[model samples]
Target: MTMAYKNVIHGLQKDEGTKENLFALVFEQGMSTNAASIKLAIPRSTAYSWVKKEKEQRSAAIEASEIARQTAQAAAAENLKVNLFALVFEQGMSTNAAAFGLGIPPSTAYSWINKEKERRDFTGEASSKTAREISKEDLKENLFAMVFDQGLSTNASAIQLGMPPSTAYNWIKKEKERRDITGEASSKTAQEISKDDLKKNLFALVFEQGMSTNASAIQLGMPPSTAYNWINQERERQSVTAEVTKETVQETVKETLKDNAEETVHETAREISKETSVETSVETSVESEEASTKDADSVYRVTFKL
Candidate 1:
């Protein structure tokens, strides 16, 4: 019916090998009809017709391949999401940092974090019915067990135990503080060093030792948040102190310059007055000598006349 169909029939009659080659190129190799036409030196219309028929024959296989490709892509994306989530929640990485590290978009990573939190809240609410009434001490013990033994995040453990995340965090903080006070904490920095010594160490580590905030925090056995807060406050205090010191130094310099300027002006005025007095005295002496000489001349003239 079509020129391509006619070409196919001719090919079949002339040589089956040519027809097979066309099928192999268009079907097995997945070459486009136009491309196959050039490769096989066949007519474009013949190639199109052969490719169309081959597509119909292999439609199921093509559909299956596409589905497989989509599934694989979806699986890879899910794996990436899981890894990023773990990095943020389990490993204490910030969402943006984790996203950047994993080459994920920050907005997408934030959405995932929100979804996970929502899921956790829903699960916590659903399981609240089975939540047992326990003493504060028992709850604290369980929280510690979940965190230390099972390696669960504080938020995750709080959700499992049907407690608010803030409450869990506060309880943990208090416990740590109590342990530190009793010298039972494992951190040598916290247990052995006094508060003043700890502050000095933190300052030296960051400013004098030229360490990063995180590294300083680690060396001081303090939470990064706490370390950052201390560093920020210290910087603010130092900034204020520096401003005060600069003002004081500037004032001192001004005072010193002012005194020197005043003393120089006084000395200049005294020198000018001394010079004026010396000139006045010399002029008076010269006038007195001239008057005496005239009187003597008059006296001599009078004597001569006598």
Candidate 2:
């Protein structure tokens, strides 16, 4: 057609084709070197070289590209995974809780949780440092209602809640200690911790500051009857303590008195015995002015023994 050709064989065009002649059989027919070579009656090596040249030229057109975007995306994913791990395992938060905090799906969080479980089981490592904070609500509401409001023992509360009694006890003990250490800075308000806490405060105001029960109740935002009852209990407790102290003092005094009297008697007897043990001799010499029969003398011996 254009008469511009790349290669020729005798009088036929090699890179050009007509109805009676064909060229570039390997590419035009989409044939492999083996098939094209046999079809075109050419050596297999010649067909292979043509295919190789095209492959090299096409490959040469491609250039290397920077992958910073992809690297940053991968790093962000890794960081998310690390944060999820810390919240779920290290902080003792549940999968759903950690997921909610991270704004991730709960299903994804649970999947990661299972994967971590398996990894830790295989590796024999533990990540948790404390019990879950979510359980504090159990202590504040459920356990408090059962033990204080319903008059159930701690063990009974545990049974009702389907947890180990020791777990409940430890949680309560630690919570109380935490509250004691932090005071007003505790996670819960004082009344939320226990209504009795408010009652005790009311009683303290009444007894310590001599405020009336009505005034204390009003100040503490409690019912007057409840405040009065708590104040009465506190007074009764103090009365019992006073009675015990008085009895103890009386018994101590009696013992001391009896022991001192016995000791005084024993000491007096010892001193008297010691004084009597020494010798007391009285000798008198007088010239005999009147003696019976001029050589007769009378002598009397006086002796006192203790």
Candidate 3:
């Protein structure tokens, strides 16, 4: 036998000192531990412990007598505190509460409860089935996966999952923009937003061409306000249109000056024609006077000569 067993056996040995101590007591005469405990000043617990040591020779015998009796009595209990299911249905205990009382695994208890529900369903006992609640984390993960992996539209996902289309779109848009609650851009948003080819094309057509927001919206099949917002956002990116408004203004001014110069030339030509006509009239008058004077002089000379 092991050392512990030997020690226990040794402790059970009858001892003269214990007997004498018991005899000195008022009650401990010939009686066993229980009777001696009643009569003697020594404690009944001490007396019983002594007897237990003495009875070590009959180890199995003592155990078979009291321990077995108690064990059997406990086993004979009729109700025996039913398991989680019975407690839940018959005693109205919650699954969690029942699980706690029974020391069974909570998951197991919950499974049992669910099984009970399924049974009720099969039997047409329960009126309706409740949908399992979705958590925020679950929604975030699913939305991310749907957008990235499945290539599903946000509105489509919302329709499928019975969520608000706007909410789904907002989540996707926010993630694409990388605008975190902290006002910082996340890498995921930057990547997703960049991947939107439609957005890129739309911005190019709108801001680059100076296309009106409504026209751009019609082309892109989006709201005008949305197109306007995207045009503003395009400005944040590299310059959409290379030629500035200053260059256009300068070109327009140059054309205007050229037109004005041509009109001025036409007016100057008309004034020159009018001045030429007046000069011709003065020359003709002078010519006529000179001719008459010449004729008179000639006549006078002829008379003198004669």
Candidate 4:
């Protein structure tokens, strides 16, 4: 009957879903061919063919939309809000309020709180260091502790101690082999490789393989500096990793403590009778304590050779 009907007859001679959708939004809705063309952003001829098909299959589109809506609603109820502060500050609710609303746990809320604190304190790496002569054994022990125990990389430790990248790389490479052969747990060894093999492998991965030092450290399961050193040495562009300051670390810790305090405040507030507002303020007054320059535990970065 129309030019549009001719186009639809030719175009959807194949696909059914497009035919059904066109039918539902046009013929069943009693929409004019011009209106359907604008609504579906298609030529009027295609709308006529869809309208003809929709007249034949009216029930299916209604059923599909109903199913989709129900599935979406169910997913929304079950989804956990992993970012607590966003659930709180952005949503204008407290941690307890957000957790209850989102169907998530209190511990998840606390983890997000600490994560937020770490994010806040992550200023670009800048620290002050005092160099001290550490014995080779002690250095080996520290390196082992950093890599294996602490899961840090060499550049991270070098940044903390303010040492040359080459110095950290050389020491770890020497110690890893000695520990492996002696069957001691002090240094981490490469699987089935000599000292020369270790250096060559490290160089190839850093330079030719083109992996970043941190990524190489994770792949090699060693420290960051070891990987960084090999790459730097091969390229002849030795760049020192900037340090993160004690002050920055302390600030991060303080923010964490503050979040803990807020959680405690929230827990206490939740216990008070909700039927009637009972304003009870419990203040924890601790006297001023001396601030120390050092961290509670020493943090070292380990470098991994690829």
TM agreement with the true structure for every prediction:
0.40, 0.30, 0.29, 0.20
Candidate 3 lDDT score at position 258: 93
Question: By TM-score, how accurate is candidate 2?
Answer: 0.30
lDDT of 2 by residue, 1-306 (tens): 334442235235543332112235555766567877687676677667767876676566542223566677679767878998887556555566567778888888788778877997677664542333444453456775665454445655675565557766876677567757977334554435566566567767877888899998778655566667778888899999999999999999999999999999999999887766542211111233345334433332222221
lDDT of 4: 0.58
lDDT of 4 by residue, 1-306 (tens): 799998897665644655555666655786677786787677777777766655556567878888999899667633543444555444334455556556677677657656655665475211222121223345556665665455456656544443445666777676677766787754443322343455666666766888667876677655666667666675554232223455677889999999999999988777765423433221111111212212322222222321
Please provide, for model 3 over 130-233, each residue's C-alpha lDDT reduced to its tens digit, 9 standing for 90 to 100. 32222444666677676655554565556555455777788788775664666655345433564376577676776688777788767865556656776777
Candidate ranking (lDDT, best to worst): 1, 3, 2, 4
The whole-model C-alpha lDDT of candidate 3 against the native structure comes to 0.65
Give the C-alpha miss distance for residue 244 in model 3, angstroms: 6.4
In terms of TM-score, the best-performing candidate is 1
Weakest ten-residue segment in model 3 by summed lDDT: 128-137
Give the total clashing residue pairs for model 3.
3
Winner on TM-score (1 vs 4): 1
- Number of the top lDDT candidate: 1
How many Å off is the CA of 18 in candidate 2?
A: 99
Cα lDDT of candidate 2 equals 0.64
Q: Assess the local accuracy of residue 108 in candidate 2 as a C-alpha lDDT between 0 and 100.
A: 82
Alpha carbon lDDT of each predicted model: 0.77, 0.64, 0.65, 0.58
